[model samples]
Target: MQSSSKLFPVALISAELRGDLTEDVYLLKPNNSPDPSVELALTRLGRAGHDGARGVPVVLLHGSFANRRVWYTTGGQGLGAWLARAGFDVWLAEMRGHGLSPRNRLYRDNRVADYARYDLPAIAAFVGEQCAAPAHWLGHAQGGLVLAAALGGGYLAAAQLASLTLCGSQISRLHGVLELPPLIWAARLLLRRREQVVAGWVGPGEGYEEEPAGMVRENLRWFGRFGEGRQDWAAGLVEVTIPVLALAGAADRSAPPAACRQLLERFGSPLREYLCLGRAEGFAEDYGRAAMLLGGNAHNEVWPLLEYWLRHQRLPERR
Candidate 1:
């Protein structure tokens, strides 16, 4: 399944070396959306002068309220860099209205449906076109949710997508006062009035990006419905047979371990695996949502597992 948008005006905006890694940034115009102003920014990482002749292509997607920087910080190495150095064609995607991707004409009106149904599939097609091979996908938090929706919604197909990896994303686990109908109504009302959710309003850190109220509201709707409005998210995922690896933070209150397990159970893929990080699971300490991908511990302990998983996927022949 291809994206509804047309691709054009693709450009490589910058290229620089970071500690033996070559980072190149590209901009892609889908040429169609509710808003014509939106464009996607993809960052490519590889060794200097290295061609695609010997590597599997991998796409790294960041969570909500974040940008492409989630994959790597300036002058610093992250998972994408590690994967590149490990011989994978790594592409980091910045979602619409986040990071290098500018807000579109209907920015506030955008929904996860738009992301799953249009943006990601389009980006995948573009990456495949450039690499001449299907791409392995790794998504964190909200990025994972969008990936699930895309595959389950039929906007993305196994033909062009080799495998999937999700970190800190789950469809259920909303509880207590957060699930009260009146509370949901009040939250939606408040979100509709606010232009955006500010950074630092979320976690106790420096990385969260500002997000449109519509995005928050749409998420709230899912939380309230406990599913994607009319679709059975669990059932949809059950139909997908791609290999999947779901990593969860044991101490993640945002998306608890049990909830993440629920997500894992819903996948019909016979090759699916779920790993929860915590001391009980043989790790030094329990990890939280952000810690799943960030921090020194993640780099030292978690990154290798991811590397091993990606290494198992062979590059697909160009169709």
Candidate 2:
């Protein structure tokens, strides 16, 4: 299966030596992409002493305006590193113009429609070739939406996926003004003069990278119709049948638990699970958006539940 990977065209850009693990970065340029200069980065983290024997392949995707740092810090302290240390073949993906991936010609014009239709399928195919097995996909925010779009559009086949996990992501929650097409159209029209939108200037976070206004436009469209281009992804979601795990933070007003549950309900999977992180859910605190994953107590509280689910495909027992 590994030998067949050569059939796909991928360029290995660099290999960085981490303490105990090796990080191999590959740039995948799918032939079908509208932009020939587009190259999506896929970073693989694994150790050598395991004799190349890998556990299940798991792909980690970052949210909007974020990068690979969401999964692993420079010090190798996040979930990507933890999963690598645990023997899972982990791959962290950087969407166009994010993290290690350089901006493509269409960077300003790229949207989730391009990501879900073009980038993700290429990533999955590359991972599938290397691992010779289906991957378990885990994403946060816009990353989750990309996964949903890929699954719903049939860009990613069920045979290429082991499971799906969504964190702090939902389309059910509507942003009143943001949901209006005319307003979004006006925003995009205004953004034509701007190259990128800084998360700190507009949203609640700091240190986030600048993102294409196209992403904001696409998200608004999803919030309004859950469809992109000509495809009705909202209607297509019911066709996804893989086991799914959806998580929400109790204090995450951005993506409330109720909204996340609505997204979970749309999946056709028989094995669907939902969990809300808060004192009511037996957690120490009511986790907010980033707090749910990167909080000080997450290592002891949240990470274990994620590991358990990735390993067992079931909810962990209440403490």
Candidate 3:
């Protein structure tokens, strides 16, 4: 149940069979975090038949107000299961106080800064240690922003990563209404009154939890439409030279294609590539924020493209 290495402690909760795939969940405590009670939950999905051998490692991070279910479902579906079936070592990470991860002492006070500064690197290091190789990372929406913050702050080293993918993530989108203090207060009040949807595909009911107010405040600050300006992302982001892929949803009003493109353009990686998911780009339909990963056509159309990109570290071959 519980195990420890010299570095930190890793507790294996359970290993169950999800049809043809194996699911293993662990609670990882990183010693570097300011809060010792901060433990992250990671679910590993692997296929049968490969003795113990693992293919390339891939870590999937969900957006804010979401959890691991964003990339995986209990029925062994979603991108995480698909990657596992394809022989890649796939990890679904649940942020602190979300899903399988329990709340820390200062859970409500947590911010993206806390996640980027401590949590992400810890997860990456643990993955690398297990697979003995740098792992690829994919972030959706706010998850992508966390990745960018980690890289920009020099918290996650390039050597620790194989590649980076930001799906429908951008900081350039300005929400002018959030600038008003009264509106910000009202937003928090509303979030408390309603169920926060963690599973975007599940629609307005169930799979919900209340998000921390501190995180909401930090998110607003990042927009720079109010409060002080955001951190100087360029200094650290331009230093990131890892292979990068930035994907945008054509119909995603939350993060438009132009904003996504702007984020990708700031990266220093010479191998940077941009993709727009829409009919014009040969995709089945114009993807929205959540549809980019959960739409009906995603498995048949988008997943294959992701697999190819991860394997080749290049753009997928067009049909």
Evaluated with lDDT, which candidate comes out highest?
2
- Minimum summed lDDT over a 10-residue window in model 2 is located at 1-10
Instruction: Write the residue-wise lDDT of candidate 1 on 1-319 in tens digits.
Output: 3332246667777778877888888777776566667788888888766764538899999987888778887756778877888888999999888888878777777778888777887788788777767888999888888888888777788778778998988888553466677887888888887877887544455257888778778877886343465776557877898888888898887788888788878888888888888888777679888887776698877887788888774322212
Q: Each model's TM-score? A: 0.90, 0.94, 0.89
Instruction: Tally clashes: model 1.
Output: 0
State candidate 2's TM-score. Answer: 0.94
lDDT-best of 1 and 2: 2
lDDT of 3 by residue, 165-236 (tens): 999998876444565767766766655544332433223422345566567766655554312235575456
Candidate with the larger lDDT of 2 and 3: 2
| Alpha-carbon RMSD of each model | 5.0, 2.5, 3.4
Q: TM-score winner among the candidates?
A: 2
Record all residue pairs in model 3 with backbone atoms less than 3 Å apart, i.e. clashing: none
What lDDT tens digits, residue by residue, belong to model 2 across residues 195-312?
7889864457633888887777666656557876788887788988899999999988778899899989998999999999899988999998788778998888888899999999
Backbone clashes in model 3: 0
Per-prediction count of colliding residue pairs? 0, 0, 0
